[model samples]
Target: MRDYVQTAEEAARRAGHVLRAWSSKFTVREKSRSNLVTEADEAAQAAIHDFIHGRYPHHGFCGEEGLSVAGNDSTYRWVIDPLDGTTNYVHGFPYYSVSIGLECRGEMIVGAIFDPIHDEMFLAVRGEGATLNRRPLRCSAINQLDQALVIASLPVNTDRHDEAVRRFLSVLPVAQAVQRTGSAALNLANIAAGRVDGFWSTSLKPWDMAAGILLVEEAGGRISKIDGSAFQLEVPNLLASNGLALHEQLVAALV
Candidate 1:
Protein backbone atom coordinates (compact mmCIF):
# COMPACT_ATOMS: atom_id res chain seq x y z
CA MET A 1 0.00 0.00 0.00
CA ARG A 2 2.89 2.37 0.77
CA ASP A 3 4.46 1.64 -2.59
CA TYR A 4 1.15 2.23 -4.33
CA VAL A 5 0.69 5.49 -2.49
CA GLN A 6 4.18 6.65 -3.37
CA THR A 7 3.80 5.74 -7.02
CA ALA A 8 0.41 7.48 -7.24
CA GLU A 9 1.75 10.61 -5.55
CA GLU A 10 4.71 10.72 -7.93
CA ALA A 11 2.47 10.23 -10.94
CA ALA A 12 0.07 12.92 -9.78
CA ARG A 13 2.90 15.40 -9.19
CA ARG A 14 4.50 14.72 -12.56
CA ALA A 15 1.12 15.14 -14.25
CA GLY A 16 0.58 18.35 -12.30
CA HIS A 17 3.79 19.76 -13.66
CA VAL A 18 2.66 18.94 -17.17
CA LEU A 19 -0.68 20.67 -16.60
CA ARG A 20 0.94 23.74 -15.07
CA ALA A 21 3.33 24.08 -17.98
CA TRP A 22 0.47 23.94 -20.48
CA SER A 23 -1.87 26.16 -18.52
CA SER A 24 -0.87 29.30 -20.34
CA LYS A 25 -1.18 27.85 -23.81
CA PHE A 26 -3.50 25.00 -24.59
CA THR A 27 -6.23 24.19 -27.09
CA VAL A 28 -9.64 23.16 -25.88
CA ARG A 29 -12.41 21.09 -27.43
CA GLU A 30 -15.88 20.33 -26.20
CA LYS A 31 -16.16 16.84 -24.80
CA SER A 32 -19.91 17.36 -24.40
CA ARG A 33 -22.48 20.14 -24.44
CA SER A 34 -20.64 22.13 -21.76
CA ASN A 35 -17.79 19.88 -20.69
CA LEU A 36 -14.37 20.75 -22.07
CA VAL A 37 -11.09 18.93 -22.60
CA THR A 38 -7.74 20.47 -23.51
CA GLU A 39 -4.50 19.40 -25.06
CA ALA A 40 -2.93 19.48 -21.61
CA ASP A 41 -5.29 16.74 -20.47
CA GLU A 42 -4.10 14.32 -23.13
CA ALA A 43 -0.45 15.17 -22.66
CA ALA A 44 -0.62 14.85 -18.91
CA GLN A 45 -2.40 11.52 -19.11
CA ALA A 46 0.28 10.27 -21.48
CA ALA A 47 2.99 11.25 -19.03
CA ILE A 48 1.16 9.55 -16.15
CA HIS A 49 0.53 6.42 -18.20
CA ASP A 50 4.17 6.14 -19.14
CA PHE A 51 5.35 6.71 -15.60
CA ILE A 52 2.99 4.26 -13.89
CA HIS A 53 3.23 1.59 -16.56
CA GLY A 54 7.02 1.79 -16.36
CA ARG A 55 6.91 1.26 -12.61
CA TYR A 56 4.34 -1.54 -12.62
CA PRO A 57 4.04 -3.21 -15.95
CA HIS A 58 1.62 -5.79 -14.61
CA HIS A 59 -0.98 -3.33 -13.36
CA GLY A 60 -3.99 -2.11 -15.32
CA PHE A 61 -4.81 1.56 -15.93
CA CYS A 62 -8.03 3.44 -16.65
CA GLY A 63 -7.50 7.10 -17.52
CA GLU A 64 -9.92 9.88 -18.45
CA GLU A 65 -8.05 10.70 -21.61
CA GLY A 66 -8.98 7.29 -23.07
CA LEU A 67 -5.67 5.70 -22.11
CA SER A 68 -6.51 2.21 -20.96
CA VAL A 69 -3.72 -0.26 -20.32
CA ALA A 70 -4.56 -3.83 -19.39
CA GLY A 71 -1.67 -5.67 -17.85
CA ASN A 72 -1.09 -9.19 -16.57
CA ASP A 73 -2.28 -8.46 -13.06
CA SER A 74 -6.07 -8.38 -12.88
CA THR A 75 -6.39 -7.51 -9.23
CA TYR A 76 -4.71 -4.08 -9.32
CA ARG A 77 -5.87 -1.11 -11.32
CA TRP A 78 -4.86 2.53 -11.42
CA VAL A 79 -7.64 5.06 -12.03
CA ILE A 80 -6.33 8.30 -13.48
CA ASP A 81 -7.84 11.69 -14.14
CA PRO A 82 -4.69 13.43 -15.30
CA LEU A 83 -6.42 16.78 -15.49
CA ASP A 84 -9.65 17.02 -13.56
CA GLY A 85 -11.56 20.29 -13.88
CA THR A 86 -10.64 20.67 -17.50
CA THR A 87 -13.12 23.50 -17.87
CA ASN A 88 -11.45 25.38 -15.06
CA TYR A 89 -8.02 24.58 -16.43
CA VAL A 90 -8.91 25.88 -19.89
CA HIS A 91 -10.26 29.05 -18.34
CA GLY A 92 -7.33 29.45 -15.96
CA PHE A 93 -9.46 28.95 -12.87
CA PRO A 94 -6.59 27.30 -10.95
CA TYR A 95 -9.01 24.93 -9.22
CA TYR A 96 -8.20 21.80 -11.20
CA SER A 97 -5.98 18.89 -10.14
CA VAL A 98 -4.32 15.60 -11.04
CA SER A 99 -6.20 12.72 -9.38
CA ILE A 100 -5.07 9.11 -9.12
CA GLY A 101 -6.55 6.21 -7.18
CA LEU A 102 -5.40 2.61 -6.94
CA GLU A 103 -7.83 -0.25 -6.44
CA CYS A 104 -6.83 -3.76 -5.38
CA ARG A 105 -9.37 -6.54 -5.70
CA GLY A 106 -12.10 -3.95 -6.21
CA GLU A 107 -11.18 -2.02 -3.05
CA MET A 108 -9.59 1.38 -3.15
CA ILE A 109 -6.19 1.00 -1.45
CA VAL A 110 -4.41 4.27 -2.20
CA GLY A 111 -5.22 7.72 -3.51
CA ALA A 112 -3.55 11.02 -4.40
CA ILE A 113 -4.78 14.39 -5.63
CA PHE A 114 -2.39 17.21 -6.54
CA ASP A 115 -3.49 20.82 -6.99
CA PRO A 116 -0.62 22.11 -9.11
CA ILE A 117 -1.37 25.79 -8.91
CA HIS A 118 -1.42 25.71 -5.10
CA ASP A 119 1.09 22.87 -4.70
CA GLU A 120 -1.21 20.97 -2.37
CA MET A 121 -1.08 17.19 -2.35
CA PHE A 122 -3.90 15.27 -0.67
CA LEU A 123 -3.14 11.61 -0.11
CA ALA A 124 -4.48 8.58 1.69
CA VAL A 125 -4.14 4.84 2.12
CA ARG A 126 -7.03 2.72 3.29
CA GLY A 127 -6.95 2.35 7.10
CA GLU A 128 -3.94 4.69 7.40
CA GLY A 129 -5.75 8.06 7.41
CA ALA A 130 -5.40 10.98 5.00
CA THR A 131 -3.09 13.99 4.58
CA LEU A 132 -2.62 17.32 2.90
CA ASN A 133 1.01 18.14 2.15
CA ARG A 134 2.18 15.53 4.70
CA ARG A 135 -0.02 17.01 7.42
CA PRO A 136 -2.78 14.88 8.88
CA LEU A 137 -6.30 15.77 7.75
CA ARG A 138 -9.76 15.25 9.18
CA CYS A 139 -13.27 16.31 8.27
CA SER A 140 -15.01 19.15 10.00
CA ALA A 141 -16.91 18.44 13.21
CA ILE A 142 -19.95 20.47 12.25
CA ASN A 143 -22.96 18.46 13.26
CA GLN A 144 -25.77 20.63 12.00
CA LEU A 145 -26.84 20.97 8.39
CA ASP A 146 -27.94 24.59 8.84
CA GLN A 147 -24.44 25.61 9.86
CA ALA A 148 -22.57 23.42 7.40
CA LEU A 149 -20.96 24.73 4.23
CA VAL A 150 -21.77 22.45 1.34
CA ILE A 151 -20.96 21.99 -2.35
CA ALA A 152 -22.55 20.26 -5.31
CA SER A 153 -22.38 19.84 -9.10
CA LEU A 154 -25.14 19.36 -11.67
CA PRO A 155 -24.98 16.74 -14.33
CA VAL A 156 -23.95 17.78 -17.84
CA ASN A 157 -26.60 17.33 -20.51
CA THR A 158 -28.83 15.17 -18.44
CA ASP A 159 -32.60 14.98 -18.07
CA ARG A 160 -32.18 14.96 -14.31
CA HIS A 161 -31.03 18.57 -14.24
CA ASP A 162 -34.41 19.67 -12.93
CA GLU A 163 -34.24 17.17 -10.10
CA ALA A 164 -30.70 18.30 -9.26
CA VAL A 165 -31.76 21.91 -9.22
CA ARG A 166 -34.56 21.03 -6.84
CA ARG A 167 -32.11 19.19 -4.61
CA PHE A 168 -29.88 22.26 -4.50
CA LEU A 169 -32.87 24.37 -3.67
CA SER A 170 -33.69 21.97 -0.87
CA VAL A 171 -30.21 22.38 0.58
CA LEU A 172 -29.87 26.12 0.04
CA PRO A 173 -32.19 27.49 2.70
CA VAL A 174 -31.03 25.01 5.32
CA ALA A 175 -27.27 25.01 4.85
CA GLN A 176 -25.02 27.94 5.67
CA ALA A 177 -24.16 28.14 1.99
CA VAL A 178 -23.83 26.08 -1.18
CA GLN A 179 -21.34 26.30 -4.03
CA ARG A 180 -20.33 24.59 -7.24
CA THR A 181 -16.57 24.49 -7.66
CA GLY A 182 -16.42 22.85 -11.10
CA SER A 183 -14.22 20.12 -9.70
CA ALA A 184 -15.73 17.22 -7.78
CA ALA A 185 -12.22 15.94 -6.97
CA LEU A 186 -11.27 19.22 -5.32
CA ASN A 187 -14.59 19.40 -3.54
CA LEU A 188 -14.03 15.97 -1.97
CA ALA A 189 -10.47 16.89 -1.04
CA ASN A 190 -11.82 20.02 0.59
CA ILE A 191 -14.31 17.95 2.54
CA ALA A 192 -11.45 15.71 3.69
CA ALA A 193 -9.38 18.71 4.72
CA GLY A 194 -12.27 20.21 6.69
CA ARG A 195 -12.45 23.18 4.36
CA VAL A 196 -15.93 22.10 3.27
CA ASP A 197 -18.44 20.25 5.37
CA GLY A 198 -20.22 18.32 2.63
CA PHE A 199 -20.42 17.53 -1.09
CA TRP A 200 -22.92 15.82 -3.42
CA SER A 201 -22.81 15.32 -7.12
CA THR A 202 -24.58 13.45 -9.90
CA SER A 203 -23.40 12.08 -13.25
CA LEU A 204 -19.73 11.77 -12.30
CA LYS A 205 -17.18 9.51 -13.91
CA PRO A 206 -14.92 7.12 -12.00
CA TRP A 207 -11.85 9.30 -12.48
CA ASP A 208 -13.61 12.33 -11.09
CA MET A 209 -14.27 10.91 -7.62
CA ALA A 210 -12.08 7.82 -7.25
CA ALA A 211 -9.14 9.44 -5.47
CA GLY A 212 -11.24 11.96 -3.60
CA ILE A 213 -13.56 9.31 -2.21
CA LEU A 214 -10.68 7.57 -0.46
CA LEU A 215 -9.43 10.88 0.83
CA VAL A 216 -12.80 11.55 2.44
CA GLU A 217 -13.14 8.05 3.90
CA GLU A 218 -9.67 8.09 5.42
CA ALA A 219 -10.27 11.58 6.78
CA GLY A 220 -13.22 10.39 8.83
CA GLY A 221 -16.00 11.25 6.43
CA ARG A 222 -19.03 9.29 5.27
CA ILE A 223 -20.05 8.61 1.67
CA SER A 224 -23.14 7.09 0.08
CA LYS A 225 -25.39 7.38 -2.90
CA ILE A 226 -27.98 10.14 -2.99
CA ASP A 227 -30.61 7.59 -2.14
CA GLY A 228 -28.51 6.29 0.78
CA SER A 229 -27.13 3.20 -0.93
CA ALA A 230 -23.56 2.06 -0.65
CA PHE A 231 -21.29 4.02 -2.99
CA GLN A 232 -19.60 2.05 -5.71
CA LEU A 233 -17.07 3.42 -8.16
CA GLU A 234 -19.45 2.69 -11.01
CA VAL A 235 -22.32 4.57 -9.37
CA PRO A 236 -22.50 8.16 -10.57
CA ASN A 237 -24.48 10.03 -7.93
CA LEU A 238 -23.09 10.38 -4.39
CA LEU A 239 -23.29 12.36 -1.18
CA ALA A 240 -20.25 12.75 1.07
CA SER A 241 -20.09 14.55 4.39
CA ASN A 242 -18.25 14.80 7.64
CA GLY A 243 -19.20 11.65 9.56
CA LEU A 244 -21.01 13.65 12.18
CA ALA A 245 -24.64 14.32 13.01
CA LEU A 246 -25.23 16.27 9.80
CA HIS A 247 -24.84 13.27 7.49
CA GLU A 248 -28.40 12.07 7.97
CA GLN A 249 -29.66 15.61 7.63
CA LEU A 250 -27.86 15.94 4.30
CA VAL A 251 -29.20 12.67 3.01
CA ALA A 252 -32.70 13.55 4.05
CA ALA A 253 -32.61 16.91 2.31
CA LEU A 254 -30.97 15.63 -0.87
CA VAL A 255 -33.11 12.54 -1.19
Candidate 2:
Protein backbone atom coordinates (compact mmCIF):
# COMPACT_ATOMS: atom_id res chain seq x y z
CA MET A 1 0.00 0.00 0.00
CA ARG A 2 2.81 2.39 0.84
CA ASP A 3 4.52 1.54 -2.42
CA TYR A 4 1.38 2.40 -4.36
CA VAL A 5 1.06 5.59 -2.40
CA GLN A 6 4.62 6.45 -3.27
CA THR A 7 3.95 5.84 -6.93
CA ALA A 8 0.86 8.00 -6.78
CA GLU A 9 2.80 10.80 -5.18
CA GLU A 10 5.56 10.53 -7.75
CA ALA A 11 3.09 10.63 -10.59
CA ALA A 12 1.28 13.60 -9.12
CA ARG A 13 4.54 15.49 -8.64
CA ARG A 14 5.62 14.67 -12.15
CA ALA A 15 2.36 16.01 -13.49
CA GLY A 16 2.76 19.07 -11.34
CA HIS A 17 6.07 19.74 -13.02
CA VAL A 18 4.40 19.48 -16.39
CA LEU A 19 1.70 21.89 -15.36
CA ARG A 20 4.20 24.42 -14.07
CA ALA A 21 6.28 24.15 -17.19
CA TRP A 22 3.28 24.93 -19.31
CA SER A 23 1.91 27.75 -17.24
CA SER A 24 0.84 30.80 -19.26
CA LYS A 25 2.19 29.12 -22.40
CA PHE A 26 -0.65 26.73 -23.18
CA THR A 27 -3.61 27.43 -25.38
CA VAL A 28 -7.03 27.34 -23.76
CA ARG A 29 -10.09 25.64 -25.18
CA GLU A 30 -13.61 25.60 -23.84
CA LYS A 31 -15.02 22.20 -22.99
CA SER A 32 -18.49 23.67 -22.59
CA ARG A 33 -20.13 26.90 -21.50
CA SER A 34 -17.99 28.32 -18.69
CA ASN A 35 -15.97 25.08 -18.64
CA LEU A 36 -12.39 25.45 -19.79
CA VAL A 37 -9.50 23.16 -20.69
CA THR A 38 -5.96 23.91 -21.74
CA GLU A 39 -2.88 22.34 -23.27
CA ALA A 40 -1.37 22.18 -19.78
CA ASP A 41 -4.11 19.75 -18.72
CA GLU A 42 -3.34 17.40 -21.57
CA ALA A 43 0.40 17.68 -21.06
CA ALA A 44 0.16 16.94 -17.36
CA GLN A 45 -2.08 13.90 -17.87
CA ALA A 46 0.23 12.59 -20.52
CA ALA A 47 3.16 12.93 -18.14
CA ILE A 48 1.27 11.10 -15.39
CA HIS A 49 0.03 8.32 -17.67
CA ASP A 50 3.44 7.75 -19.16
CA PHE A 51 5.14 7.52 -15.78
CA ILE A 52 2.51 5.32 -14.08
CA HIS A 53 1.81 3.13 -17.10
CA GLY A 54 5.50 2.66 -17.67
CA ARG A 55 5.95 1.41 -14.13
CA TYR A 56 2.72 -0.62 -13.88
CA PRO A 57 1.98 -1.62 -17.43
CA HIS A 58 -1.11 -3.65 -16.59
CA HIS A 59 -2.86 -1.07 -14.46
CA GLY A 60 -5.94 0.54 -15.91
CA PHE A 61 -5.94 4.28 -16.50
CA CYS A 62 -8.67 6.90 -16.51
CA GLY A 63 -7.83 10.58 -16.78
CA GLU A 64 -9.84 13.80 -16.98
CA GLU A 65 -8.34 14.60 -20.36
CA GLY A 66 -10.22 11.74 -22.10
CA LEU A 67 -7.52 9.10 -21.68
CA SER A 68 -8.87 5.66 -20.82
CA VAL A 69 -7.25 2.23 -20.74
CA ALA A 70 -8.55 -0.87 -19.00
CA GLY A 71 -6.28 -3.45 -17.49
CA ASN A 72 -6.74 -6.89 -18.94
CA ASP A 73 -5.86 -8.94 -15.83
CA SER A 74 -5.26 -6.44 -13.08
CA THR A 75 -7.47 -5.03 -10.39
CA TYR A 76 -5.55 -1.78 -10.11
CA ARG A 77 -6.92 1.31 -11.83
CA TRP A 78 -5.61 4.87 -11.52
CA VAL A 79 -8.12 7.70 -11.81
CA ILE A 80 -6.48 11.05 -12.46
CA ASP A 81 -7.31 14.72 -12.64
CA PRO A 82 -4.00 16.08 -13.81
CA LEU A 83 -5.28 19.62 -13.58
CA ASP A 84 -8.22 20.03 -11.21
CA GLY A 85 -8.63 23.81 -11.40
CA THR A 86 -8.20 24.70 -15.05
CA THR A 87 -9.80 28.11 -14.91
CA ASN A 88 -7.63 29.04 -11.97
CA TYR A 89 -4.58 27.74 -13.74
CA VAL A 90 -5.48 29.61 -16.93
CA HIS A 91 -6.12 32.83 -15.08
CA GLY A 92 -2.91 32.48 -13.01
CA PHE A 93 -4.91 32.16 -9.80
CA PRO A 94 -2.60 29.36 -8.57
CA TYR A 95 -5.21 27.20 -6.80
CA TYR A 96 -5.11 24.25 -9.16
CA SER A 97 -3.69 20.79 -8.42
CA VAL A 98 -2.86 17.33 -9.73
CA SER A 99 -4.94 14.48 -8.29
CA ILE A 100 -4.32 10.74 -8.54
CA GLY A 101 -6.23 7.92 -6.86
CA LEU A 102 -5.78 4.18 -7.09
CA GLU A 103 -8.73 1.82 -6.95
CA CYS A 104 -8.59 -1.88 -6.22
CA ARG A 105 -11.66 -4.06 -6.60
CA GLY A 106 -13.81 -0.92 -6.79
CA GLU A 107 -12.51 0.56 -3.54
CA MET A 108 -10.17 3.49 -3.23
CA ILE A 109 -6.91 2.24 -1.75
CA VAL A 110 -4.38 5.00 -2.45
CA GLY A 111 -4.70 8.73 -3.03
CA ALA A 112 -2.43 11.69 -3.78
CA ILE A 113 -3.14 15.38 -4.41
CA PHE A 114 -0.29 17.78 -5.14
CA ASP A 115 -0.53 21.53 -5.32
CA PRO A 116 2.23 22.84 -7.50
CA ILE A 117 1.97 26.45 -6.48
CA HIS A 118 2.22 25.76 -2.79
CA ASP A 119 4.20 22.54 -3.15
CA GLU A 120 1.76 20.85 -0.78
CA MET A 121 1.41 17.10 -1.16
CA PHE A 122 -1.52 15.23 0.43
CA LEU A 123 -1.44 11.45 0.55
CA ALA A 124 -3.58 8.68 1.99
CA VAL A 125 -3.85 4.90 1.94
CA ARG A 126 -6.91 2.91 2.97
CA GLY A 127 -7.04 2.30 6.72
CA GLU A 128 -3.90 4.39 7.04
CA GLY A 129 -3.92 7.93 8.37
CA ALA A 130 -3.65 10.71 5.86
CA THR A 131 -0.76 13.18 5.60
CA LEU A 132 0.04 16.60 4.26
CA ASN A 133 3.69 17.21 3.36
CA ARG A 134 4.51 14.02 5.31
CA ARG A 135 2.81 15.32 8.45
CA PRO A 136 -0.29 13.56 9.79
CA LEU A 137 -3.58 15.16 8.87
CA ARG A 138 -6.87 15.28 10.74
CA CYS A 139 -10.11 17.19 10.29
CA SER A 140 -11.03 20.28 12.27
CA ALA A 141 -12.99 19.90 15.50
CA ILE A 142 -15.85 22.24 14.70
CA ASN A 143 -19.03 20.17 15.12
CA GLN A 144 -21.67 22.85 14.88
CA LEU A 145 -22.72 24.41 11.61
CA ASP A 146 -23.03 27.84 13.15
CA GLN A 147 -19.32 27.80 14.04
CA ALA A 148 -18.02 26.21 10.87
CA LEU A 149 -16.29 27.67 7.85
CA VAL A 150 -17.38 25.74 4.77
CA ILE A 151 -17.09 25.71 1.01
CA ALA A 152 -19.34 24.74 -1.91
CA SER A 153 -18.89 23.69 -5.50
CA LEU A 154 -21.28 25.14 -8.05
CA PRO A 155 -21.11 23.88 -11.57
CA VAL A 156 -20.03 26.27 -14.28
CA ASN A 157 -22.89 28.49 -15.43
CA THR A 158 -24.99 27.70 -12.37
CA ASP A 159 -27.88 30.16 -12.02
CA ARG A 160 -30.21 31.52 -9.34
CA HIS A 161 -32.88 28.87 -9.90
CA ASP A 162 -30.45 25.93 -9.84
CA GLU A 163 -30.70 23.56 -6.86
CA ALA A 164 -27.01 24.18 -6.20
CA VAL A 165 -27.57 27.89 -5.86
CA ARG A 166 -30.52 27.32 -3.58
CA ARG A 167 -28.43 25.04 -1.38
CA PHE A 168 -25.65 27.62 -1.33
CA LEU A 169 -28.02 30.32 -0.14
CA SER A 170 -29.48 28.08 2.53
CA VAL A 171 -26.05 27.33 3.98
CA LEU A 172 -24.75 30.90 3.76
CA PRO A 173 -26.66 32.24 6.72
CA VAL A 174 -26.27 29.06 8.74
CA ALA A 175 -22.52 28.51 8.63
CA GLN A 176 -19.97 30.90 10.03
CA ALA A 177 -18.94 31.48 6.42
CA VAL A 178 -19.61 29.99 3.00
CA GLN A 179 -17.28 30.21 0.01
CA ARG A 180 -17.35 28.98 -3.55
CA THR A 181 -13.95 27.73 -4.71
CA GLY A 182 -13.49 26.48 -8.24
CA SER A 183 -11.41 23.50 -7.17
CA ALA A 184 -13.30 20.62 -5.58
CA ALA A 185 -10.13 18.54 -5.16
CA LEU A 186 -8.44 21.19 -3.03
CA ASN A 187 -11.65 21.78 -1.08
CA LEU A 188 -11.72 18.14 -0.04
CA ALA A 189 -8.04 18.19 0.83
CA ASN A 190 -8.58 21.27 2.99
CA ILE A 191 -11.35 19.44 4.82
CA ALA A 192 -8.92 16.60 5.49
CA ALA A 193 -6.20 18.95 6.70
CA GLY A 194 -8.68 20.62 9.05
CA ARG A 195 -8.33 23.88 7.18
CA VAL A 196 -12.05 23.84 6.40
CA ASP A 197 -14.89 22.27 8.32
CA GLY A 198 -17.00 20.81 5.47
CA PHE A 199 -17.79 20.84 1.76
CA TRP A 200 -20.40 19.53 -0.67
CA SER A 201 -20.99 19.46 -4.39
CA THR A 202 -23.72 18.04 -6.60
CA SER A 203 -21.69 18.28 -9.77
CA LEU A 204 -18.37 16.41 -9.98
CA LYS A 205 -16.71 13.74 -12.05
CA PRO A 206 -15.01 10.63 -10.69
CA TRP A 207 -11.55 12.10 -11.10
CA ASP A 208 -12.64 15.27 -9.36
CA MET A 209 -13.38 13.62 -6.02
CA ALA A 210 -11.58 10.29 -6.16
CA ALA A 211 -8.33 11.14 -4.35
CA GLY A 212 -9.84 13.79 -2.12
CA ILE A 213 -12.57 11.44 -0.89
CA LEU A 214 -10.04 8.98 0.46
CA LEU A 215 -8.09 11.82 2.04
CA VAL A 216 -11.18 12.99 3.92
CA GLU A 217 -11.93 9.48 5.20
CA GLU A 218 -8.36 8.70 6.14
CA ALA A 219 -8.04 11.99 7.94
CA GLY A 220 -10.96 11.05 10.20
CA GLY A 221 -13.63 12.98 8.30
CA ARG A 222 -16.99 11.72 7.01
CA ILE A 223 -17.99 11.52 3.37
CA SER A 224 -21.27 10.69 1.66
CA LYS A 225 -23.70 11.87 -0.95
CA ILE A 226 -25.48 15.15 -0.33
CA ASP A 227 -28.59 13.22 0.75
CA GLY A 228 -26.47 11.21 3.25
CA SER A 229 -26.47 8.08 1.11
CA ALA A 230 -23.36 5.98 0.62
CA PHE A 231 -20.69 7.54 -1.57
CA GLN A 232 -20.34 6.27 -5.12
CA LEU A 233 -17.55 7.35 -7.44
CA GLU A 234 -19.91 7.09 -10.37
CA VAL A 235 -22.27 9.49 -8.66
CA PRO A 236 -21.54 13.20 -8.93
CA ASN A 237 -22.80 14.46 -5.56
CA LEU A 238 -20.79 14.42 -2.31
CA LEU A 239 -20.69 15.83 1.22
CA ALA A 240 -17.46 15.73 3.24
CA SER A 241 -17.04 17.06 6.76
CA ASN A 242 -15.18 16.69 10.00
CA GLY A 243 -17.29 13.97 11.55
CA LEU A 244 -18.62 15.13 14.81
CA ALA A 245 -22.14 16.38 14.56
CA LEU A 246 -21.10 18.24 11.44
CA HIS A 247 -21.90 15.39 9.06
CA GLU A 248 -25.51 15.20 10.10
CA GLN A 249 -25.80 18.95 10.23
CA LEU A 250 -24.40 19.27 6.71
CA VAL A 251 -26.66 16.52 5.43
CA ALA A 252 -29.68 18.36 6.73
CA ALA A 253 -28.52 21.68 5.35
CA LEU A 254 -27.52 20.33 1.93
CA VAL A 255 -30.54 18.14 1.35
Give the TM-scores of the predictions, in the order they appear.
0.97, 0.98
Error of 2 at 117 (Å): 0.5
Indicate the residue-level lDDT of 101 in model 1.
Answer: 94
Model 2 C-alpha lDDT per residue in residues 46-85, reported as the tens digit of each score: 9999998888999998899898899774698999999999
lDDT of 1 by residue, 100-192 (tens): 999999989999999999999999999999999999999999999989999988877646448888898899999999998889899999999
Error of 1 at 144 (Å): 0.5
Q: For model 1, state the Cα shift of residue 115 in Å.
A: 0.4
lDDT assessment of candidate 1: 0.91
Stretches of candidate 2 exceeding 4 Å from the true structure:
none
User: Among all windows of ten consecutive residues in candidate 2, which has the lowest summed lDDT?
Assistant: 67-76
